[model samples]
Target: MQSFRDEIENPIVQKEIIDLEKKIYSFRNGQIDDERFRSLRLARGIYGQRQEGVQMIRIKLPYGKVSSEQLKRITEVSDKYSTGRLHITTRQDIQIHYVSLDRTPELWADLAKDDITLREACGNTVRNITGSELAGVDVDEPFDITPYAHGLFQYLLRNPICQEMGRKFKISFSSSEKDSALSYLHDLGFIPKIVNGEKGFKIMLGGGLGSQPSHAELLSEFVPVNQIIPTAEGVIRVFDRHGERAKRLKARLKFLIKDLGRDEFLRLVDEEKKALPFHSYEIETAAFEGPITEPLLAVPSVTIDDVEAFEAWKKSNVIAQKQAGYVAIGIKVSLGDFYTDKARVLADLIKNYGANELRFSLRQNIVIRNIKEENLAFFYQELAKLDFVTLGYNTIGDVTACPGTDTCNLGIASSTGIATELERVLATEYPQYADNTGISIKISGCMNACGQHNMSEIGFQGMSINSGKLVAPALQVLLGGGILGDGKGRFSDKVIKIPSRRGPDALRYILNDFEANANGQSFLNYYDAKGEKYFYDFLLPLSDVTNLTEEDFVDWGNADNYVKAVGVGECAGVVIDLVATLLFEAKDKLTFSHEALQEGKWSDSIYLTYAGFVNGAKALLLAEGQKTNTHAGIIDLFDTVFVETNKIELSSSFKDLVYQINKKEPSEAFAKAYIQEGVAFFENIENYRAKDLANA
Candidate 1:
């Protein structure tokens, strides 16, 4: 571990790992607060799982793009640090479960060697930027969104504005108006648009799905390519200032936009423009345009023993790219779970026979790109060895599901268990759906909707039914949800709830009904024509829990009877109001401010200094039993409680001192001065707190 830590080339990343190690030691020794430690670890992409004393480390793969070398490196780390399995998230990141907290830093160092990161994959920070899997190859796309997604990810990583926001932020880029990335459900979603030959995007803001799904509103008809960073920065600034902090469920950007009207929110974003570091940040797209790398080894000659199976696989998995004579191959990773050994083979296969890059799709599948038309059979034969040549790639049989009770803390029932059963039902009963992409099915462990159940034509949310003193795992059936393209979509309506064992029957009923009455309409249109109540009427019998047997009490994939065991969810980092911890965090912020100044990140340095000031003030405010719910509120309250009362002395009012961040540009001179002042302010706050403690 020490050897790899020494070998880490990036000074910033090395320091981050070292700091994580030190923090872990502190946490183990009872020197750090549990909530504070959770926040720190989550920012580094180490998340707490349902099981005790283990973690799920999410490896951030920007836009789901992974090179052959990076894939090999991930497999190596997974084999060493976690279970030899990888779970592809709906957001296009890879997660490995059951990692020890103590060894996370070393594991991170290993992944960093291949330029793969775990940073910001979880926590109240800007998460991995997801994009359409077919961004570069889509025939209908105006231009590829790969570079923009990559550029935005690079800009926001470890950036001060989003690091400590009230809640996590999500961003997505769709390749075209097709909205394949599901733009309507992201905090900030972009769809490629060419306005009079100038490349730009139609911006959608404040979209999210959870217990309360909110459709994104149009932020702008068009934003030029270069102005995206500035736009994102402004929106984040406003969200950070006024987003809900005390209420975890209401802390998302969508809720903020809802509380403050869109007009007022846009006004706040406009106000933040003066303080932005860049008015127009041009992205370099050339590097992402062509083939990542030519195949080093020739395509192996192969013969298919089962020609019928091979043809069926190719019909669903093969996707033609916009580039002439090239295609992309899709691998249907069931429930997003794949072993590391198969992943190693896939890495080598892509490197040797095709372009050395592949993307993990938003539906938790793999897409290998740049394969030659003539080489399809060979690639298919190679994939068949690993059992990757499934019949349905993105079709109805390709059910998307979260880990559910298998790993997630908030799971009420088994999602993967039911999803697997439903997929089997589709393959056996409705084989024709394998080539149909019109109807999509998704499942979530709970209402948090990690599997994105709310935006599919058929959806199920994990739930539980109480039968007097006994409990049975159950699922909530939802219907009529579909994306309408161009940053528009509808959330599924909850239809009925049934026992987990009855999930297969529920799907059978729905499919049978659709087939009988649909009259050749699209699934969404058919669902709408019949209405939500119509489906509920037919599926009502399956919801009966009065006659549940012993088998109904046992959840799918479990031998024991179902017990509703839910751990405290760490989806958003816990809120810590400890005065001492806040003071300690203030000092840490000051240190980061000095480091950012040394690195010449003026905007970052200035923001860090501002955060330091706010944190120090909030510590004293909390000591006085005052509320510090938002940064703006903290600034105002600190002045009234301390500065005006003459309890603390400052050169100016606390509001003026902290508000200097947005009043001036992020120049080197201002950053240095702000950091120096922040350091002094920390000293003063510490002295005041000590005296107050002595008096008490």
Candidate 2:
């Protein structure tokens, strides 16, 4: 049980927390690294978030699987140390946010006894290694890849060569044809296969999500079992050597893959592989560890009641297990947000009853693996306590919005609030359209597009305008973007720029249109029968006003971005977060010197400019979260950066900043140079750093 001191109200702790922040920042700035210093930083709750004072503590639940006891611990830690919510990320890892600056180390210690880890979850280090939850147990009859995934994890965890890369790299493992794990969306996607009777892997190189997204290119036809490490090493080497270190925004693997054609990228890998000494492995079964035997289980007795509902959930959400009498249950969580109490109770129930194996899903949900038929009823009842068992109906309100204003500092329009309100409204008003399956609507507060609104069946992104003298907030809508379980993946189109308020109605209008013209058929079948143009015309109609048109066009998802100086934060869209830290060392100087407020083209409207400043600052903080700039310094504080970023009073700043700079324009080299000069200015100081014109 947790002690009373763990609570925020505990005396003799708040000051300690304050002191801890100093130590953490000191250590981060390289002032200290002693064990005591490190321990103090950890103890103070100074975790390495994507930024300073922002803590992102990633808990390792082996193989994307968490035990109930472990889960309960997570709940406790979150409730005590954080905002009391846990985010089940795209990777099978659980991330907690709004974590206090000092309670971080204590949070780490709380889970220390249970074999969980928070090390390397953030920073310029290898993040949590993820794999298919059912690596060995899928009855689909493919090779088990648990050992391979685990082996890679062990080797890469703090391995001198991989601890730091050109950028963060994610590796995903899949055992079957099903892309359930969305392995192709990762930097290194490993698929298990046998070649000439020996187990091996088919490696796909250089895929990622972010400002620039790329589908991995198949590199190795058959990487021998022993050579997986070296091949991966080659991929890393190529990335580190050729990665865009100068331009932070364009520095991801997707751009690398784009720069290097598929064949050339593989050729570089092959060349790197040729020089490395290979270590072969003794062949064993290549999948995962066998299912946990009941003898090892601490499961309590469960009583069944609701058979029909359970069966229905099992039909669409649950999948077959390799182990008999066991099934994998998928809990359809909305965007993977879990509160602390909810986490703790669910963890308790899961640990005591489930197989001590909890799987996080890609669509932001939790799954209990190896659940017995006998326990379904009891588990259902328990889940209901934590709000785990809600039926999902796909509608305008069934929107998947990222943590817009809740935690992230870069958000413009509060994606979570909008999504919740929209989902609630849509669920209540349009039952027919809301209940439609095979449909998804996603929202991202800003153009950095963490929400991946670009891939939504219906998508919304935050945008703003100088509506007369007042700044007007709105959402731009994109239609038809989606992935397919049926192998017909198509990207959504930027059909209309819908306002934030009209977002739900616009979506409902489209779905209802789909409902009317669907001609009484299945989802995909209807889309197939009615081609893109037919559906486009039906949804958009003749005019946009009485016909329902949204606000402005403000999205360019994963298709190469422009020279983005500052992005919108998940919390608020700000442009000058670093100005205080950068412009004035002593914040007290603000009273004497009005330089920042006066000479800096910063608008006189304190309310509006301050809001933009907050948004821009948060966006910069989030950009810091990407591990691109870790020196606690600011870059791109110039007129070009601020004007494009909306830090200054530019009318079309958002659009102009997001406008794609043609790769081949005026020689791609010169265009890249201008961007590079702007990016490199803040850090290098003498050569390229430009004064902040907006707050000069």
Candidate 3:
């Protein structure tokens, strides 16, 4: 209470009010609109999100570590104004919704109290720094990267030079070879190691995923870890000085990295490192805890009988401690959906009943460290109230899924739903898969691919396909995805695709096959050795039904007369749903019927081709039209839809193109195609022509 009052006291509030009043005086003739203001802000690296009237603010949670004080502030601010739900994103960020724009200042003030804030949380800026989630706990790691992650976060947050760059940049730290952080796939990846008997990091440059995906290359080896800040500053300086400032879509670090060869890039980085502020002790090894805390609970003193399954739970669910007898218990939360009220209750319990330390895991789960055996039952009871404590912490559909169409306009499909469905199917057809601990599966809704599907033992990406007039749903299967336990790392391979509706069957078949073939190796290792040929050869036969008489309808995927076939993932939903609706009768909303036509404005023919777009640019056409509507709505929607459609050409191959909402710029060719497609599809609808290139 004393601390709260000391912090919120007065002159600060009045100073802020005066400052804001002064800033408000510079408004455009005292008549600025939200859109214009938003655009101006965006151009300068600010963002505005759509939630309720209350703004939904996104703040980067890089590498997923925050100070205890920061966490308390988050809770306090959230409770004061919000519904109190903090979403931990797949990119390792925290987002809060239902905040009023007017209250933004107040919210910011509260955040400032804890040295936390919303800087570069949106727009085309480098997001929060991310590090391996297990950085401080995984014993297999060479060293904990928490200090470095925080250090970099401090250095990068609103840095003057980094405030403006060619595009958003990403950085990751990996002390372990596991690469669970997926460092190779980021803009900057740091791998811990010892070179010349000196401990430091092997830094990689120019890695990212966007329209074009590229892995980073090694730039410097054994750069003392302490030199990270200066080395980073130099690299950013170079990027700031040299990265593309002309093309918006082509401005990513990957483009820069691609433009320069590995050797030259390294030379540049080395040259830049010369002027950096490097310290000798920064790269030295730092200590961290083990991956799993041993069960902190001691032997029971009373005659309390527990189920046999409890023993398995104790073994598989609880990780052992580096220290004798102390265990870390993982309590998985489905969808990471827990109430703020519940968090308070749990925090109170930890303070009074359990250990003081509570750790949040990347799997959208939470852990309580060092609980005495005698208090296990009591701790379990408190967690049960929040509906988070479960014996099956890592089982079934406790699947990792990035936010999709639900919140991110960038999504092509609904990943959360798909994850739920997959879990249901697996549980329905094969319960053992849920209980199977060896295989790790992940899913993503967009090419942003936050689920880290590329490295899962088995992974799925949401997609769509055109089946006549109906848009059929499907998933692309990625196999051979694996991360090193410690730095020998290789991501999995893409094996096949299957209909989304049939995802469960495909997963079961794949898992069962592994079960039978395993000569005692883990699922991931066995699948790696099983090779691509085995999977393709097995799944290929099911793609197109050869003969009606031979096709097994009982086990095969078929809704009515159409058989489901595999297709590309990511933006696949948009085009395929378009195709499916155009060809078949409607069973679901994806049909190309009146309901679909009514969904948006671009469903008309005037949108097709660049010629049509150029011709339709009659600014004041609403001057005399019988459409019975103003041009305002039409113009806004047209720009929104067209921009998304045109932006996916580069990475759509890897993305599910079911719907288009590209964050980058579209090409002339792409814009031409979009307009043409829009015009043609809408104009000659009764005599639809999607089978040929003329329509596609």
Candidate 4:
């Protein structure tokens, strides 16, 4: 087989591929630890599935933008490597499942030919940087944030700082204050703003959705456009320095900010500014500027069999672009899964009729932009032929769901199953809501919220109910959660838990009540007026397990009895506490610090060295079976357990040694000294571990 090393042109990418191949070989041969291997593969977007030996490859498309060529390329790769099915995630990445682990490198190489990447798509690194799907063309946007979002993604991808963080970090950009990108649920949310006609962004920090959802705090009302990168770097640096590590659930930036208090967190962020590579990294928007296209051809007169159906589709699916004489079309990808054959047809249709570029929305749908106004009928007809013309683009009928038991290891129930059923209920029973954009529905198989259920107007989280000795699949129905725009949102309140089979009935009851009493108000307004208790009271009967028939025990889309089987989750990767591995990683960080110093990256060198110190200390702490939760905690515990106890001697406290990065400017002198400190720390830990092993 031809190696990717020869096929890939970029030296850096080639080296990355070669390294992955080497690591995979080592892992397969048992030369690498299982936990360490899991982390490595996850960082490269090769995720383990519930069905062992197969992988789920997540292709990272920054801001969900994909050209016709790229989409076709993806389809080709999917067809060759796995099932001809493409799954779009809420973060706007595409995933292909049941892939052989050995073929991932080949699959990735094929993707890179079309400028697609899989790096950092998973694991405790910066996930795909998402932005408004309509960023460039949104009429409400002060300016196109496409360039800025792309710029940030470029700056952070494969950056040393976030390569191996405590947990995954998410960032998003909204085109306007409407926050269509759902900025409020991201780790760092950016909304475009204009200050005296100068571009800026209102920043939101530490927002996340998991089992426990917390709204992001407003980090800054407005920061100049040029400062976005630098400010983001500063925030990441702080997160790296202090974010929790030991506990998987509490490791998110939101928890860190909550624990430290927002004021302290911001202070730390401001303190890291001096170490930033650039004080103002101005983004060049030339690449993302509006493309010049040929004049639109005359509208083709087509006989419509159902004018009313076509009009409804137009009202819900077509969005007016800021660019005059053009529009954007939204294609509701049911449950975000589409076959490769249809994908190819859609790709060709967009390339021939519309702009060659398209973006996948956070709601797991596609938005084809720059379509000539006159081509709407023609485009609809072409799309209808492929069964891609769905009327409810972002309405309640358009449900977002994660691939729960179908693939996800953490899924307790079938999210996609229930989501499909609920969408059917809407289409067949509640057809009046075909164009109603007043509400949103989302589902997640687990509390990790991959489906982003916590931020939807109506949400369902997969759970299990214990009925006497029987445990059956259940849905935790939540209500009143949604984005309030401009870095504001609410987490859904769990109103009731019911059998998974009753999900459609539960939806019917809620919708029936809302339609009767809402008086044409939006779902959010009606929800607020009705209050949580009122809705809970209304849906209370659904929670009665005593009335469940044998069918109720069966999960959606499953004919057999539902079994609550949840495998290990790979979303956060694995925590490898092997002493040798930890020490080896510390040495690797020290080597990285030296490289950064040679490259004139003083701040990068300093931070790399800091990580070296933390890893080295964590090795010793793990040896003692001591808990190391955060970087701050590791430093403090190391001083007490090793340095102060005289098991290892140091010139100063471990806290002072590691925390020096915060006090001093990231000059060459300090960076050199810090690298030396890291080297000494690694050596000390190595010797201690060796001695301890000898004694054992």
Candidate that would win on lDDT: 1
Q: Rank the candidates by lDDT, best first.
A: 1, 4, 2, 3
Give model 1's TM-score versus the native structure: 0.98
Worst 10 residues of 3 by lDDT: 568-577
What Cα-based lDDT does every candidate model obtain? 0.92, 0.54, 0.54, 0.89
lDDT of 2: 0.54
Please tell me which model should have the higher lDDT, number 1 or number 4: 1
- Residue 190, candidate 2: Cα error in Å is 2.6
Off by over 4 Å in 4: 293-308, 598-600, 667-673
Give the per-residue lDDT digits (tens) of candidate 3, residues 378-422: 554455567664555656446777655455545555567667766
Model 1, range 514-589, lDDT digits (tens) per residue? 8899999999989989998999899999988788899999999889999999998988777779999999889989
Tens digits of per-residue lDDT, candidate 2, 1-696, equal 964235444222443434445666776776654333433333222333334466656665445867777777787777777677788765666778767655665666566545566655543345567777666668863677777777777666534334333356677777665644555566877777677797777776666655445566667667777778777766765664455543556656777778777777767666554323333444344344554645244545665577687665555556678877777766667767878777767666666666666777555667777777666666677776666666662233446667654455465665775677667766687765533556777778777666767666677777653434334445766666555421124445555554455666666676677778878875545656766666556445322433322232222221221121223221110112232243222221222123323433121111122222222332443433432231112123323354454444433333333122211222233333333332232233222224333434
Model 2 earns a TM-score of 0.68
Cα lDDT tens digits, model 4, 1-696, are 976558877767777787888889998999889899999999999999999889999999999999889999999999999999999999999999999988888888888887889999999999999999998889999999999999999999878789888899999999999998888888999999999988999999999999888888999999999999988988888887788887888899999999899999989888887667688898988877656454234446677788897887888899999999889999999999999999999887777766688999999999999888777888888889988887899889999999999998999999999999999999999988888886899999999999988888899999999888788899999999887888888889989998898899999999999989999888989999999999889888888988778887888888899888888999987677887788888888899889889989898798889889988899889989999877778889999999888999889998988888878888999999989888887888788888999998
The alpha-carbon RMSD values of the candidates against the true structure, listed in the order shown, are: 1.3, 14.5, 16.3, 2.1
Residue 654 accuracy (lDDT) in model 2:
32
- List residue ranges in candidate 2 displaced over 4 A: 1-54, 60-63, 123-125, 194-198, 274-288, 295-317, 393-399, 429-437, 484-489, 519-696
Which order, best to worst by TM-score? Answer: 1, 4, 2, 3
TM-scores of the models, in the order given: 0.98, 0.68, 0.67, 0.96
Q: Which stretches of candidate 1 lie over 4 Å from their true place?
A: none
The 10-residue segment with the lowest total lDDT in model 1: 287-296
